[model samples]
Target: MGDSHTSHTGVRFELLGPLRALRDGVEIPLGPPKQRAVLAVLLLQEGRPMSYDGLVEAVWGGSPPVHVRNLVQKYVSGLRRALGDGPLLEWTGSGYRLSGAAVDDLRERRQLVDAALAARDAGELRRAAELVARAEELWRGEFAEGLAAPCLAAERLRWSEKRLSVLEARLAGQIEAGRPFESVHELVRLAAAHPLRERPVELLMLALCRAGRGTEALLAYEELRRRLAEALGTDPGPALRSLHARILRQDPALLAEPVPVG
Candidate 1:
């Protein structure tokens, strides 16, 4: 392989939303949707060869061609040309597979966010924030943007939920560190975007209380209670209810309490 091709062979592939390739600090194009789908399946099976039938099932469901193997090979050839050779893609007796060196963003994000949570649990708030920030930055809108497939759609929701969880944790950490004022604007934005999520509602209440706006905090909780009943036929969770009681009691402890890291 040419030096450039050899160096680029182990390009990281991201297929959680849209297909993206990162090699040498730049994103190499993975072509149109079908071509991207082909790469998605290959990346999904990274480090392990997949049979022709497996690729066909992943890409075409039950409508694959009799010449599925040959067609798959053609797609692989295009990817190899675009990706440059080294161990990017290979055909084997088992079928076809992308090399393990291909970076999987979903796996990486999970690890980074989990590590950050662990650090937070240990009271290493600064390092936890950095790790969570880095992980959240990995997301580029919906996974596989412009790519259409039932499989990708289903997978997108799973990744989106994980990303949201990470965001919630990171934002909670910021609030705990006395940065709720910085995140107040963000919490407002989140409330606007996700009116149903109770965590943001609680966080906003706490932020208001911390800023000495106890009256406003009580009003916010009342609004959330109304919204939850109207939209979800439910009440606030235990934490939010307890916080509301604290607000009502004018508990000095509420003001002195450390924001619990989530």
Candidate 2:
């Protein structure tokens, strides 16, 4: 959790989708929701010690039970019993610390993304795309999903945005690598799914223009413009505006061979 260990064996903690713990590839049954919530908070901290008050604030938000500390201790104890009291989780004087032996899905996903970027920088386009695909596969669902605790829900949103960024990067890479037409269909779905995310729409417009469908590209911009006005009471930002302007001018630059993005 703190740093990359050479061995990704041992215990694995999955916080990307659901709160799950696996030892040697076998799922370990973590206790009830509260106990799993405690583990979720610890897992998010990534080896940093979480104090009692911090755990309560995260798990219970503004309305913790009367004997919250005792309940916390009880949950921790239950977790220990369920996990066989291994040194993976420990009390570090003031608070609980999860050891680095646990291979977290979040950390693994970041590593994959970094590798993908490295592959792109080296011009190994196929390898880079494969790495990105692998990274995308790591997410089974939302972060710490199906957990109702306030803290877990917050993490779910944070990771959701990050995953979207990863997907956007993949689309951008393919689009800039002279595969604009191929990118159009995927970008259409992505833009629709996240209507306010202008980046996907930007890519969609570029792809449309590259495919010699200038009119359709212009219509795409209009649709986004209207959607923004209808939803947020705002117009597209300068980036989208400038792209729209270029498409209107039938910018020759749009016809130029695409450059691969790093």
Estimated TM-score for each candidate: 0.82, 0.90
Indicate the residue-level lDDT of 256 in model 1.
Answer: 65
Q: Which pairs of residues have clashing backbones in candidate 2? A: none
lDDT of each: 0.75, 0.80
Q: How many steric overlaps are in each model, in order?
A: 5, 0
* lDDT, residue 26, candidate 2: 69
TM-score of 1: 0.82
